[model samples]
Target: RVRSASYGGTQMRYRLQAGATELHAAAPAMHAHAPGNEVTLALPPERLWILPVEQ
Candidate 1:
């Protein structure tokens, strides 16, 4: 489920969750989205990034 989002001119920030896993991701803004919406992502592996957080 999508919790929140910020859509800029050409990019967007999305907050989504599945079970106990939550993710914040950025992508090009081409469509409109809002809270409580379920989304399916088909990101290409070569264009995806997974950064590890250091605490």
Candidate 2:
């Protein structure tokens, strides 16, 4: 699953998850604009494990 949030004016945050496990996470640092209003961030992939939640 992928989730995204926009901070207005070309700022956004994205999170990726898979089956109760987080795959990648990233947040915008500052407002930046590219040639075609594109922003990119490099993030390392992290290993995630699913743990049972006690209710």
Candidate 3:
């Protein structure tokens, strides 16, 4: 999970991997002054893969 703050709002990126495949997903652009202070995305287990291991 990676979070970035911008002038307008914040952006989050989540990447998941399964076996040799990887899945990258992120939330929609959330504008400032929005209602919620937190945003969440529910992803399937198979679709969520952790970062690749570096050698």
What's the TM-score of each model vs. the native?
Answer: 0.75, 0.26, 0.29
lDDT of 1 by residue, 5-48 (tens): 99877988898897898888776888767889998877689977
lDDT of 1: 0.83
- How many residue pairs clash in each candidate at the backbone level? 0, 0, 3
Better of 1 and 3 by lDDT: 1
Clashes of 1: 0
Per-residue CA lDDT of model 2 for 1-55, tens digit only, reads 4544445444444454455854333345474233233234454446444568769
Cα lDDT listed for each candidate: 0.83, 0.45, 0.46
Candidate 2 overall Cα lDDT vs. reference?
0.45
How many Å off is the CA of 2 in candidate 1? 0.8
lDDT minimum window of 10 residues, candidate 1 = 24-33
Comparing 1 and 2 on lDDT, the stronger one = 1
Query: What lDDT score goes with residue 1 in model 3?
Result: 20
